[model samples]
Target: MKGFGLKVTETGAKSYIYQYRIGGRGSPTRRYTIGQHGSPWTPTTARTEAERLARLVGQGFDVVAQRQENERKSVSLAMPAYVEAFITNYLTTQWKDEADGAATLRKHVVPVLKSKSFPSLTRSDITAVIDKIPAGQMATRRKVFAILRKMIRWGIGRGDMPQQDNPLVGFEAPPAPASRDRTLTDGELVLAWNAADDLGYPFGPMVRLLIALGQRREETSAMEWNELDAASGVWTIPAAKSKNGKAHIVPLNDVALAVIDGLAGCADSAKSANSANSARRWPKRGLLFSTTGKTPASGYSKAKARLDKLMVDAEAKRAKETGDSAELIDAWRLHDLRRTMATGLQRLGVRFEVTEAVLNHVGGSKAGVAGVYQRHDWKEEKRDALQAWGRFLEQLAAGEPEQSNVVHLAARG
Candidate 1:
């Protein structure tokens, strides 16, 4: 306790310090700040800590340097810094959809646990974040917690986090959302198609393409011009952008091609407008449904809401003319379009294998041993099925009878 003393700042804040020399007489003195004067660090505790530091310093341990190193490590191991490290080093390298995982951490995890150190985060800290998500958004809650658990486990394995106990250990993840079987009815499909026509540009053409192609919403929204071969009438989804990690080719019929053609003008106009405001030059074959021309078009929620309003208005107008009660269209998501396409394809007498192929689904006919053995791409079958589906949609839009004969033709092909 020879070099122990209480240092009071100008503002009257007092903290304990241990002053010592590393090399003995004539050596430069170093001061190691133990802690502030508080319940955890009173005179007696501070003196005991200073004595412990004296023992270490007497043994040539360089207590000041060790304390500095510990402080630096503590800062680096804080939740915010560690989250970025987890995203950069682990998520980017390992996950196909790294952007989603990174977004989840930044949106849900970082805001709640910003001041917590990775080793110090309690189960309550994580639960608090998860609880903030709405009960209806179980999928989002599940994803956020899953990514956090994986990130912590990855950090522990790589020695970036403590190995003693994980905050997420034995935690029951939110149950997955129920599988939806909500396919659009024929009347609903026609109403939606008309609504898309009214919606116009970017999302309008994008929705039309979704109805025509039957791909996932994200996939259809993120479609690129380069993915389409206008001459060959095919759109190829690369494995990197695909959910299934396999390249999928969709044969574009007249309907899909017309939607793409309209989008070309829309894309140019959007790009020109964006470039006029900013110095960013958009690539010719960049995102097809972009407003900024730098990233894929988002705002699906707002877009879908507008589309739904249009559908409800159109249905109401029709009801007024027919003397029926005006009613709201049943709630439907953009994903329901895929199911609608598959259902319509089945009605069109498309083979089960071909329908699955058209959707690029890896289940039913394409699962297990059949998947391993049957390597047929069903290119022609898919083309015929999608073409018939397109014709069926066109007929619905034209107020003509839905073409059942095309199904027989497609079956023959």
Candidate 2:
């Protein structure tokens, strides 16, 4: 009828259209496609739709303009898209530990809220996701919640998220886990180190290196051949892999270097075993603790559990020989070795600053303006301290008597 017609293409394809103007002749004309000229959009139905459009236009509705506006604003921002943009734009560029933040989102948040839209996601939805994390992993659960909250706040601030009040603003995160202060005793240390020796290759040598070096677990686990310089006796952790976004140099003493040397033999043995399989060939100079030679060693929990079992067995045997009641050693985590090292350094009369430096810890003695002005890396002091500690570890490993009450360290410049 009026302002309505069926247009036929050169190929004989047909569609119905409605053409109209808002302010009569003075306004530009607009065309709204009704539908293809098929069974649903027959001539009678198309005429009725055109009439309805004319009525709305007469009432100053501007149906075509309104439809265009709605179409422009209809893009749905789903949770996955928002999370991806947040990770790419904010986390990668700004966060010190970008990889971990990105991992938390991809592994925990994205999977649970894949179907939810950003604007429609509620506080309960997020709480449900946090609840899925095990009770024992409170630290991980708390971290995931904090990261998500930070991401949501960031999204809102950037206007990528909905303009309304942030749903996560008032939501509480999982309680922060209690601080850990567990340190292995000297006896426990000896037992654990011997157990690691028996455990062997990859995790075994890796743990021994950790006890001697006191570095982070992941950094030690993902050790590369290039990072170690046998002659220099230093292991350099690159900034990208470090927790604090800075490169860390760990001094290797006689004990630490021996672990590295043993790893070389282990790597050669592993390579020889896998030489028959072309796909599993071990790299000559790649991940030192890797089983596949492509990726770093994993399955840490299982390895740790095995080490614990070995320790218990050794403890029982020692108890039987001594005719003393067997007592279970206190449960300890890998991180406890770091604390034990720090404590041992204190007992050995190493300066607090040197201990902090050995751990590659930022701040403490070198925090605030002191951090900016103090250019000394304490490299020599670190070397001396680790050397002294290494000597101490060797004595323990050999079941030798304690040498001196305090070790003499080089004076810090």
Candidate 3:
């Protein structure tokens, strides 16, 4: 054959040759010299040699082809490929509504694990990443463990990851979450409420609402006018927004309503400034307390820092008159307000079940089997409890400390 060649000239010489494309059909063809015939290569040997080359070509294992396949396999097997797939496919469909879950992955999990292989990922690898998160951030540590549990379970479910080989498979995995019981005292509540006023407008009202409503930070911060019924004094938190995955009707008292009204005044004032031209431009719908009405209130960290400073200044002023330093107010988080509300409700003699209902909790009498049977909305009782609690809060916040639930003993006796 000319290609598997035998070339005989005046000085007879014979040789073998091969020609093929590196990448199939449209690729430029390449030719390679095999061996000469008549010296080491006879016609039979040349034919045998050509047969071996044909086998290699058919099996797709020529040097160039093998190299390309190896590169493809390397890329397919890479960790980044799996991470991208998991976030794109799993997180979007399954965890789409979970903002905090998504944030945890982006902030803590994804950064450390984006390029890490599932098979090679070890316990130490997970632990090291967690340890890098600043200590005392137990909540964040717990969240990381939660994300790992979900991601590892997701991988194992998908069948590529073997359960026995799973790095996250363990008896004692996530550390027990730290319990919080810090309730601001009535006097401290008043001090904090006043300080919140100095913080001003959205943050001030936000902090007050945190104390007044006992709703979660995310729910209150993202409050929309649509969620509130001004006429009925009801704020309907839809199942989509609620933590318990249940629709909750929270009855706002006068104090809570007034805070919202103040926010409305600000918005109306902004509209009135350019009502003719900017009527459409002003966001009249979305958030009750946002600079741009399309979004929810943010700047919590900075706003809280300012509120803390105001508390410190107030404490110093009190100490200046008293000559004894009134205990400097302890550093408190905004969440403490919710706890204070729960505790305060009990002090005001709000019934236990009603209190839990106000908090929209599923625990206590509402948990497990009881939750299945107890379908009652407790709407009237919840409304009463919130109204009663709201009234008690107004008394304290209005600087009437002399009238707290104290009884004169000796005179009555």
User: What TM-score, over all chains together, does every model reach?
Assistant: 0.84, 0.69, 0.71
Q: Highest TM-score: which candidate?
A: 1
**Deviating ranges (above 4 Å) for candidate 1:** 21-29, 58-69, 266-284, 402-413
List, residue by residue over 1-413, the lDDT tens digit for candidate 1: 69999999999999998899988789998998989999899999999999999999878799889878988989889888889988989888787667667778988889988869888877898899999898988888999988988988887898766777787877788899888899998889878887888887788888888888899987887788788765566789989878898999999876776566566633322121112342222234788888897667766779999999999999999998999987657788989999999999999899999999999999999999999999999988888888788788777766668564332111111
Number of the candidate with higher TM-score, 1 or 2: 1
Pull out the clashing pairs in model 2: none
In model 2, the number of clashes is 0
Order the candidate numbers by lDDT, best to worst: 1, 2, 3
Q: For residue 57, what is the lDDT in candidate 3? A: 71
| Per-residue accuracy of model 2 over 1-413 as CA lDDT, tens digit each | 67899888999999999999888799898898988998899999999999999899889988878998765433335777778778888887777656567778888898988857776778788888888888888988988988887887786786756856577767777888889999998888888888988787789888888898899987888788888765465789998778777799888775676566566643322121112441222224788888897767776778999999999999999999999887778888998999999999999899999999888888898889988898788888998999888878866755666765422111001
Residue 227 lDDT, candidate 2, scale 0-100 = 80
CA lDDT, every model vs. true structure = 0.81, 0.78, 0.71
Ranking by TM-score: 1, 3, 2
Off by over 4 Å in 3: 1-26, 29-93, 111-114, 117-119, 158-164, 200-202, 266-285, 289-303, 321-324, 401-413
How many residue pairs clash in model 3?
A: 0
